[model samples]
Target: MRIGFIGAGRMGAPMVRRLVGAGHEVRALGRSGDARRRVTELGADPVSFTAAVGTEAAAVVVCVFTDDQVRAVCLDTPLLASMPGGSVLIVHTTGSPRTAEDLATQAATRDIRVVDAPVSGGPPDIDAGTLTLFVGGTEDAVTRARPVLECYGGPVLPVGPVGSGQRVKLVNNALFAAQLGLITEAVRLATRLGIDEATLLSALQHASGASRAAATVAAKGSVTAFNASVGEFIRKDVAAVRALAAELGATMGTLDSAISAQFPDTERKS
Candidate 1:
């Protein structure tokens, strides 16, 4: 399948490489010259601009950050207007379900098929080509997308109709936030009880209570909560989940409690 990719940040860059390696015809867009070079190095054609990528590929996959960023790229890129009818657009960002649904509606009006197919697994996971993608769209659309999705992911499970992917992603992120909270407390307790952090982690990994978040915190330690790229990312993701929960008129109990512990003040200090 012919694929187009937008955003070549940490997550986006590796994903494009995987698709290219999978032997798909890939066109990619990056906001920097270095990113463009990286895409080309991966054996995929690098488009000069976001607009160029949108117009050229049969399917466009967005892997940017945030809901607003995704919206700006799609609406302002002008590639949507240039893409031919019957093209497919897939959003891979972890954002609000409403944003995905809105984009799908807009794409549909232009004779484009759109779906929310947000993904999990970190950059390392992407490189391994074992990422899990949760899809939100019609059953047919999900089935049609599986082959292309398989190029970059595993288990392309259907979450629901348009935007359901984002909804599910939100829940996933929220759970991560909560899990981090649990592990943090567990470590604090363990340390207080004369157990070392490494020892605590080794035991947890073998125990039934072990989870991905727990393992991450164990590997990263308390310091990663304040530093590291993923620390910032998780803070934003937790916030996004909280804001979405507020909009949905639901309480993000575990997630909210988790966010309070992790990033009480995440203003990105100047």
Candidate 2:
């Protein structure tokens, strides 16, 4: 497989490395010299332009940070236009479902398929080949993308159609944020009862309230420390979910309140 990749950053660099190691020819887009060097270090051929990245590639994988970057690269640029017809566009960015739907509509004219394949887990998961991918696309499109996705993903689940992957990812993030909020309350309650944060978190792992979030905070020894590491990303995902809920005329209800407690001011500014 000839693959085009963008955003060779923290999460993406490992994916590129895995794809290259899987014997796929990967062209990674790197706009700067340092970026090019990083891509080279990952064993992927470096291309300076978006158009160059997608040219002649069977699949173009996008792993940019935010929704705006996804739009700028996939919509505002000629990368999609330059991609070969029948190629698959796999987006691992966690953002609004509408973005994926819109991209699919746009790509349809050129015969390119778009898959909203937002990922869960982290760079370590990719390295271990256990990254969970919530994929949304047509049967044919998902089939075309499976081999490439499996290079790094463990459970590459096809949840539904074009935008469903983003929808699932947003909900997953919202729920995870809520769980963190609950953990925060638990820690506070433990403090009031003279049970230290560390002991409470550790004990919870054996209790019914145990969760991946709880385990993470327990490992870090405090919710504050855990938040320090992933607060930016959690806030970003929470905000995206809030915006999506608003756009759909839906309500997050208790989930929103819990997330708000954990990530205050995460609401998208209009």
Which 10 consecutive residues of model 2 have the lowest summed lDDT?
261-270
Alpha carbon deviation, residue 241, candidate 2 (Å): 0.7
The local distance difference test score of each candidate is 0.77, 0.92
After superposing candidate 1 on the true structure, give the runs of residues whose Cα lies further than 4 Å from its correct spot: 221-229, 266-270
lDDT per residue for candidate 1 within 126-203, as digits (tens), equals 888788888998776676567678876877788889888888887887787767766767777888999987788878
lDDT of 2 by residue, 1-270 (tens): 999999989899999999999999999998999999999999999999999999999999999999999999999999999999999999999999999999999999999999999999988999999999999999999999999999999899999999999999999999999999888887888899999998899899998989998997887889889888888899889889888888888888888777766777676432
Give candidate 2 regions above 4 Å deviation.
268-270
Pairing residues by index, what is the TM-score of model 2? 0.97
TM-scores, one per candidate: 0.91, 0.97
lDDT of 1: 0.77
Tell me the lDDT of model 2 at 119: 93
